[model samples]
Target: MTKCIRCQVDVADNHLNCPLCGIKLRESIKDTHVSYPEYPQIAKRKKLLVKVWTFVTISIIVFSLAINALTWKVKPIGWSPILSIAVFYIWFLGQDLYQKFNINLVAKTLWNNYLILTVFFLIVDNVTGYGKWSLNFVIPFLGIATGFIMTLWSVKNKSMWRDDIGYILLILGVNVLPFILFLLKAVDVLWPSIASLLYGVMTVVGIFIFSGRRLLYELQKRFHF
Candidate 1:
C-alpha cells in the first residue's frame, strides 16, 4: 500500500489514484487489501436513520398539506408552506452538522439557509397580515447573529481563515441590506438595522486590523486581481 500525501490515507496498490481526492498514485506492487477501514454496520445504521428521518418529515409535510387543504376556507394563511420551509431548513442544518463537510461548503450551506429563512419569514409575515416583525426585528437580528457567528468561527479556526473570509464578506453584504431597507422605509424599527450594520462594519474593521496584508492578499486572490 502507498499513502496519499494530500489526504494521508493509504491506497491499495491495485488503485491508480487516491480514492478520496483522485490524485494519481505512485506505482507500487499489486495488492488486494482494502486501503480504508470498513464499517458496514455503522453505515447501515446511518442509512436507516436517514431514511427514517426523511420518511417522518415528509409524512408530516404531507399531513400538513392535507390539513391546510381541508381548512382552506376557514383559515387560508399558508402556514403549511412555512412549516415545509422550516422542515427544509432543519434538514439542511442537520445534514451540515452530521456530515461535517469542509468548512467552506458548510459556510455556503449556512449562507444559503440564511437566505432560505429570510424568504421563509418574509412569506410568513406577509401571510400573517404583514406585521413587519420579520423585517423590523427578525431578519436584521438574524443577519447580525449570523455575521457574528461566522466571524467568530473563522477566527477560532484560523487555519481556514482564507476559506472563510470571502463568505464573511458576503455575509457583511447581507448585513447591509437591513439598514438599506430602513432607509427605504421598508423596515420600520431602526435599532436592529443599525446594530447589524455596526456589527458588520466592526467585523470588517477587525479583520483588516488583525489580518493586515494577508487580508489584502486574500481579497485579491478571491477577486482574481
Candidate 2:
C-alpha cells in the first residue's frame, strides 16, 4: 500500500497516479528525493562586484579632479581631458541616481544631456580650432549614457542582475566603439569595421539576453500561451 500525498488517498503498490485525485505519485516521490544546491557564495560575489564598481567610480572621479587641478595652469583648455572626467562623473552619477530614485525620467534626462553636450562640444571643437575633442567627448558620453539608461530601466522593473550585466556590456561596447572608429579611419582595418558593426549586434544581443524572459512572459500572457 502507498499514500497519495496530494489528496491523502490510499493507493496500490504498482500505481503511479493517485486513483481518486489523478495526481502523479511518481512526481511527488521525485520531488522529495531530489536536492537543490545552495548559492550563498554566488550572492556574496555579486554584492562584492557592486561595491567594487562603486569604489572604482569614486576613485576615478577623485583622481581626475586631482590631475585636473594639478595641471590647470600648465595644460591648454582643449588638451585638458576634462570631458573624459566629466563623462565618468556623469556615468556614475546616473547610476547612483537610478539606484536612489528608480526614475525613468532621470535616465531620459541624462541621455538628453549626453546628446546636448556632445553637440555643444562638437561645435566648440570645430569653431574654436580644437581637433578631435568632439569625437573624444562624444563617444564615451554616449556609451555611459546607454549603459545608464539600460541600468535604470532594469532597476525600475526589478531586474537588477540582468540590468547590471547589460550595463557592463554597454559600457564595454561604448569604450570600444571609438577605438573601432579610429582603427577603421587611420589604419583601414576591416576588424574595426567589424567591431563597429558589432555595436548594433551587441545592443540587440544585450536586449535579448536581459529582457528575453520578461518578454517571453509578456508574450505568453498576451497570446494566452
Candidate 3:
C-alpha cells in the first residue's frame, strides 16, 4: 500500500517509515486497501469439570445428612455423630492431599491412623453404652503403634525432626501413660499395655544408640529445662 521512495521498496505493514532505510513511505493511489487478518471473539465460559465436582460433593453431603437423620431416629446410638465426624475428616483429608502433602510423612501417617482409631473407639463406646475400652486399650495401643511408625519413618528418612525432636519425645512420653494406668490398677488388660510400652521404650533406646550424641544435643536443645 506504500512505497519507500529512498529505498524504492514496497512496504506493506502500515509503517510510517521504511524499516530498513528509515525514510518516510508514500501512500499508494489505488482505490482498494490492503486487508489484514482479524482474530475472532470468543465468549468466556465456566470450567465444567469444577462445577460438576462441586455439585457432586454438595449432593453427597446432603444425602449423608438425610441418612444420618433417619438412622438417628430409628436407633439413636451416636451413629449420626460418627457420620458427621467421618464426613468432616474426609473433607479435611481431601484438602490436605490436594494442597502440599509431600513432606512430613511421619506426622501425616500418625494423624490418619489416629483418626481411624478414634472413629473406631467412638463407635465402640456408643455400641457398648459405657466402656473404658476406648481409653484403656485403644488409646494406648494406637499411641504405641503411632510411635513405632514415626520411629521407623524417621529412620528411613533420616532428616525428620533433626532440629526439633520434641514431637518424637512427646510420643515416647505418652507411651508411659499406659504403664501408669496399670500401676494405678485402672486397666483390666495390662499385658497389652506393657507390651506397647516395651515397644516404645525399645524404639527410643534404638534411636539413642544409633543416633548417639547428635540426638542427645538435639534433645537438650528441645528440652532445655
What TM-score would each prediction reach against the true structure?
0.75, 0.33, 0.62
lDDT of 3 by residue, 62-173 (tens): 7877887778867766554556566555655654555336655546646565767577675757666747787668878888878777766776787555622566677777
lDDT of 1 by residue, 77-113 (tens): 6889889878877876776666446765656766887
- Model 2 alpha-carbon drift over 4 Å, by segment: 1-102, 149-153, 156-203, 213-225
Clashing pairs in 1: none
- lDDT (0 to 1) per candidate: 0.82, 0.59, 0.68
Better of 2 and 3 by lDDT: 3
**Residue pairs with clashing backbones, model 2:** none
Q: Rank the candidates by lDDT, best first.
A: 1, 3, 2
Alpha-carbon RMSD, candidate 1: 12.8
Estimate the overall C-alpha local distance difference test score of candidate 1. Answer: 0.82
Q: What is the lDDT of residue 47 in candidate 1?
A: 69
Q: What overall lDDT, based on C-alpha atoms, would model 3 receive against the true structure?
A: 0.68
| TM accuracy, model 1 | 0.75
> How many steric clashes between backbone atoms does each model show?
0, 0, 0
- At residue 83, candidate 2 shows an lDDT of 51
Which portions of model 1 miss their true places by more than 4 Å?
Answer: 1-39, 99-106
